[model samples]
Target: MVGRKKRTTICDKELQKEDLISNLHEPLISEILLRLSTKDAVRTSLLSKRWRYLWQTVPGLDLALYDFLNINFSNIDAFFKFVERFFDSHRESWIRKLRLYLGYRHHICGLKSWIDAVTRPKIQHLDVNYYSSDEIPVSIYTCETLVHLRLEWVSLPNTEFVSLPCLKIMHLKRIRFTSDTTLEKLISGSPVLEDLKLFGCSNHNAIQLRSHTLKKIDMDMDHSSGFVIDAPLLQCLKTKIASTKDFQIISSGFPAKLDIDLQWRRRRPLERPPKKVIRDILADIRRVSDLVITSDILKEFFLYSKSRTVRQFRNLSRLHARFAICDIEMLPALLESCTKLESLIMVI
Candidate 1:
């Protein structure tokens, strides 16, 4: 038995091509193939001639400023041409999302054709955030594929009308409204919208809203004359106001009652309120259950009470005063008087 020993050795060569093929032919590997970014997808071209086609098949393409910080902006025409070539190389017919965030002065004459080319009907999500030369393109109003729109520091034409039928949500910040009617028409057309946010926008013109599906709205019309809101199914309303002069709120469908923060300051020396101004303001939100009042408004409320009998908040369940320094003692009695109020939050 000792004389019949056998020799064993290991081979250092790689596995055969057929054995490696089985590992590459996987469902998880196929998904990873589809989700590769533009840069990473190009690397796969060196893997093999067969892998070169995978780069063109990937459907997603995102070009933001952070992706190319060192890009030469002085030669804007050349930079865009290179990006266009890259986009044209991708053979995907349908893109799920396209985001363009290039910090350049958006001239209408040069940008119009480029914008029209990218807004294919197949694109479901399109986010275009660009700083313009104080002007917004006209094609934005007629884009029918957008589901969500976010605009900041953009100047839209007064005559331009936005009539996106498929739009579900809109957020406008620091956008100068051209005319009151333009804004009104936009809100009226977007019936399927569920959420809307307006920050630092002037609303001097009359506004009308009629949405069957709208649920939440957060408006910050600070330091400007306010506008009117008339939404039927709006559930939550949160607002911030730095100036209270001529702050008119004419809401007919006083929402499902979520959270209300109302603050009115008396920085302007007004002798007295109009006969029925402030009373009408409080009456509009009489049905809201939760109320959050700031210091200035609380002082006005107590001062108005001293002059005449103002209706106590009967439906309010919770009262929160953010900074109640001198008016801390009156708050406990105010909370107990409201038959429905269960708790009070005060910070002196």
Candidate 2:
């Protein structure tokens, strides 16, 4: 009887501990559920009656169907159905963040419906990666509460008006824009935007980016014609342009860091920018503290560094460059231009 009594006492303590934990505030429990993946969070319903409906009120949802592309028709239908049901079951109208990594493109209708359903007024962050060919819904641009948006392998819709009052960070990868003015319009609409990244986006005939609150602009455009920047408050600028006539910084913003990669093909070596043009380009970014130039751009700078008209980069403190065989011969002249350079990184 004594041994049985001790065992019973231990079991009672365990039960009491669990009861205390189960009685935690609903917001605290929702936070715990938010940290879990959608599938795992929903599975918690099986843990206890209290947790059964807790996931329904969680404000964040991260859903990734890894095998979505390889699944059969029946499985795909069932997967989408489950997603639909999950959204339908959510009790809260406002989602803090929603991320979806979809593998297939055939479900455009379903994808559109899902995005429309989740892009509520209170949704702050939305990230969607669709590997298939599909244009992003125009509704995304109107999400007034969106703070951060990232879209991969999507085409931008041609809309007359775009107003994202709260958007600050935007990242576009392999995106297709309808017209040259589409990008300009998009940037103009986001009054408080700070950071923008464009990676391999199409319809880059001549992009004129003008923003009052922008701080950082990063572009990797291989097929771009030209870019004209007019952001007065910009601080960081990075670009990888394939054409010699690709980009020019027209702003007096004076970015602190500049990373430029000019891809000059050897077959058409004469396509390199003229010495005067290279010098003028360097003059624009002379205020940059940290500067990174690829081998192609370094070759142009080396050719022009011998000229007396080349200005010194007084503010440049860090210099990073890839040294080609020709660049090694003009290394001394290049170093002379960066009078305040404190760090040098050379890659062969």
Local distance difference test values of all predictions, in order = 0.60, 0.77
- By lDDT, the best candidate is 2
lDDT of 2 by residue, 4-74 (tens): 99999999999999898789999998888887877778788888988888888888778776644344225
Show model 1 residue runs off by greater than 4 Å: 1-67, 70-86, 89-92, 100-114, 158-162, 222-226, 245-252, 258-278, 306-311, 318-321, 324-331, 342-348
- What ranges in model 2 sit over 4 Å off? 1-26, 32-56, 67-74, 104-106, 265-277, 303-311, 321-337, 343-348
Candidate 1 TM-score over all chains jointly? 0.66
Q: Estimate each model's TM-score.
A: 0.66, 0.78
| Tens digits of per-residue lDDT for model 1, 1-348 | 433332211121234553465357444444565555445655677776666666555555555554544543455565577567655764346554555666555442444444555454454455556667556666666667777777776666765456677778888877776676766667766767888887877767445655677777777764455565666677777666444433343556666454434443344555544435545546544767777666555556666663332345777777676765676766655655467777777767
Error at 230, model 2, angstroms: 1.0
Residue 344 CA displacement from its true place in model 1, Å: 5.7
Candidate 2: clashing residue pairs, number: 0
